[model samples]
Target: MGFKAALSKVFAWYVNRHLNTVRQNAVALQQKTFSNLIHDAKNTAFGTDHHFDKINSYEDFKKHVPVRDYEELRPYIERVVNGEADVMWPGKPAYLAKTSGTTSGVKYIPISKESMPEHIKAARNALLSYIHETGKADFVDGKMIFLQGSPVLAEKHGVQTGRLSGIVAHHVPGYLQKNRLPSYQTNCIDDWEEKVDAIVKETATQDLRLISGIPPWCQMYFDRLSVVSGGKKIKDIFPNFKLYVHGGVNYEPYRARMEESIGFKIDSIETYPASEGFIAFQDSQKEKGLLLMVDAGIFYEFIPSDEYFNDNPTRINLKDVELGKNYALIMNTNAGLWGYSLGDTVKFVSKNPYKIVVSGRIKHYISAFGEHVIGEEVEQALMGVAAEEGVEVIEFTVAPQVAPTTGELPYHEWFVEFGKEPKDPAAFALKVDKALQQKNIYYFDLIEGNILQPLIVRSLKKDTFINYMRSQGKLGGQNKVPRLSNDRKIADELKEFIV
Candidate 1:
């Protein structure tokens, strides 16, 4: 390996060792907290059945309860909105994390006072882990910039209502909180224009060292920062900036563009942050697989990928998990979400129980034309084609659409943004077609007699997809362009730019 690559590997090994030590300490601390929570839940109105009965062992817990989705919890959310007590958890919730789901409109997920600590601890741990990984903990005491959702707290009555981001921001250390760009109680959504303007004005002279948020929003902020600073790169704005923590969705597609825009290779860390809880984070500087926080105010259960649809899905406790297998994630958080199926899939990368990589979202599977293609399958196929062709893909998306033929079946259309134009697009498409046929028999059969035609690859500009998402009001702040679409609506919407 080259000198830099070898150094990176060595540094990763060192950081991994330290990460394990910290994880062990965190687990012990969390286990005590979890035990006390279980004890408390047993005496509460919501826990008449000895709440610990079902959770005696992780395995037992998985077998007795069916996986639950957000739809099933809508009634409980209604209770919170109406100010009912002991619906999901024991007490009146302190705040709600407002989020938008695919099929559902705005949802106010309950976040109790008791559960706020989990959010804080998880978030703090994520930052600490990043510091440990990059060996930059010494430099982290500088001014840190969090490019997050607005600090506006929604209200129901005369009292201020708490949103997750707002609550967290409010509870941050006084020293750090004082340096925040916007106050926690401000109306961020309604006052976005003014807030953005204020942020530009305030940070125009600060020595900002860290940035945290989704890539799209970060890009927007950086664009503003550039404009205000005479098109200077992030290095010019924060020469000591050492880290970039990003989450929400895969940052792979936007990584190149972001780095180019920023004009520096700032160390990037990926995290799995959901309204329910902070799930996983990359602990080492190497940015290898993420380590799941086992003891963070939640009891985690893994339903084996093979058993994801079993009549009774069996749960595997955190202790019994093996390495390199995918699992449908379920969690019982202190926030009153019990046996909640997160609808996200993950796979273990090591035997150490705390580390796993997010494979994909459960509902992200594509069955266009009835081929039943999944996220992993598609990612693998694309990676394989890129490897064989010696090309690097910057971004890609696939959608199912009906071919305009006399009597043709629907097929998958691919849009690929490459770093450099491929030597031959048709040849690359043929290779991908053959790979899909070999990996998926259903796809192969459909392609043999024209039931499904060969894959079509549309070469697109680097920023085409990002611009498309922005045009649809789905870009910037927490929203991401779908990588795979089942119907033609999003596909048709994007075709204008692809062609």
Candidate 2:
């Protein structure tokens, strides 16, 4: 090996050894911490102050306290919003991480001072694990760009209470903070459009080696980068760039677009980030899926995705989880969310507890017409059909819509964006239909001799779907194109421009 390569390898070895040791220690420490916390919570819930009141098991905890969604906690958050001392947790919330749900307009999730370190530690371990895996720690310790959300925290009495990103920025290591774009606090202001514009202008000339964010935002930013740089390849803008870190949604649709925009095959690191905590992240080597931060200040429970929210959901403890089964994740975090189901599903790819693939979201499934099609199944069908027909699908979405046929029922419609038009649209559609039928028998029953017809591949101009999302006030930030819809409304909304 060359000198630099050899040094990189040695450095990776050292880092990995250190990480393994630290992870083992952290896991032990976290287990003890979580055990005590669970006990305290159980005691507190039942009006006791003793630290060890023995609420040890999941069943015991569940029996005493019912599951709660965000709405139930809104009042406590409102107390913080009104500048109360000790709103939810013991101390005043350090910052609020803004997130949105389908029904909730905007939620300001409290970020406590005690839980901040856990987030930082999980993030740090993710980055360090990636570095060790890739043996790329020697690459100038290059600039890490975070394509983050609007940095604005809600104001109480005209004073800015920091957002999570802002708080994190303040605590960033001096070395890393100097290289971050837009600074942390400045980015937290609610005006994301202006912030994105500033980010594009300022970083147009910098040598960014790493970029991390939701896929849609990154794609949009790179598109703007292309225009600002007068059609320069994204690589040209940051020639030393080595990796792109993305998560928050299924990335298959955006992968080709991102590669085409960047003009290179860049390494990607996917993560499972949520307002509750940073759950897991891709290792530096880009091998396998992300490694769950088992040592982070959280205890995990996996309920089978199919059985989630059932009258009696069966949950697998951390030790009993198996490989290759999809499970809805339930987390008990140091941030005060106990037995909270974050609504995302994952499947383990390895027996080692840390490695798993984010299968899809619980809410992103389509079963409107008795066809229970999931995100992974749809992606697989699309990929399979594309492979068989030798076509490249840039982006796609499937929606169950009521087709006004002469004495017929509604069917599922697929809106697809391809690099170019296919030779035989009908044959391509048939292949996808059969694939879906064979891959998922429930879908077959729904389509056989029923109103639900074969899959429709409404090929559109490149970036058409993304443009539609941008037009809908759901792009360029945390918003993304929904992969699967229960009805055809969203697909119909985007159809006018396809032809």
lDDT of each: 0.69, 0.70
Backbone collision tally, model 1: 0
Q: In candidate 1, which residue ranges exceed 4 Å CA deviation?
A: 1-37, 43-46, 49-64, 138-141, 157-163, 182-205, 227-231, 369-371, 376-396, 402-409, 415-424, 428-451, 459-473
lDDT of 1 by residue, 1-499 (tens): 3343344445556656655775676556445655655655654444553345456644444444456778876766676667767666777777778776776677677677777776776666666666445545533445667766666676753224644555577677664564455434332644444555666676767867677877766776777889989999888887877778888767765675678777877787788877788788776666468877765677677888657766776676666677877788887777777777787888888655367888776667666666766666677777677766767776677887676566656678888777766698889888887987887778888899688888888888767866777576655456666677676667676677664
- Cα lDDT tens digits for candidate 2, 1-499: 3454455566557757866664455445456656755643443322132222546655665565444566765665676666665334454566667666655677766666666787776666566666666656544355668877655455663334544555565566665676677655547645555667778887888878888888777877888899989999899998888788787887776677688889898877777767777788776463577777666667777888877758787876566677888898887765556656677788988644357888877777888765667888888888777766767777778887665557556766788888755689889888888888887888888778674777767777777876787676665556667788876668878777575
Cand. 2 Cα-lDDT: 0.70
Best by TM-score: 2
How far residue 229's Cα lies from its native spot in candidate 2, in Å, is 3.1
In order of listing, the candidates' clash counts read 0, 6
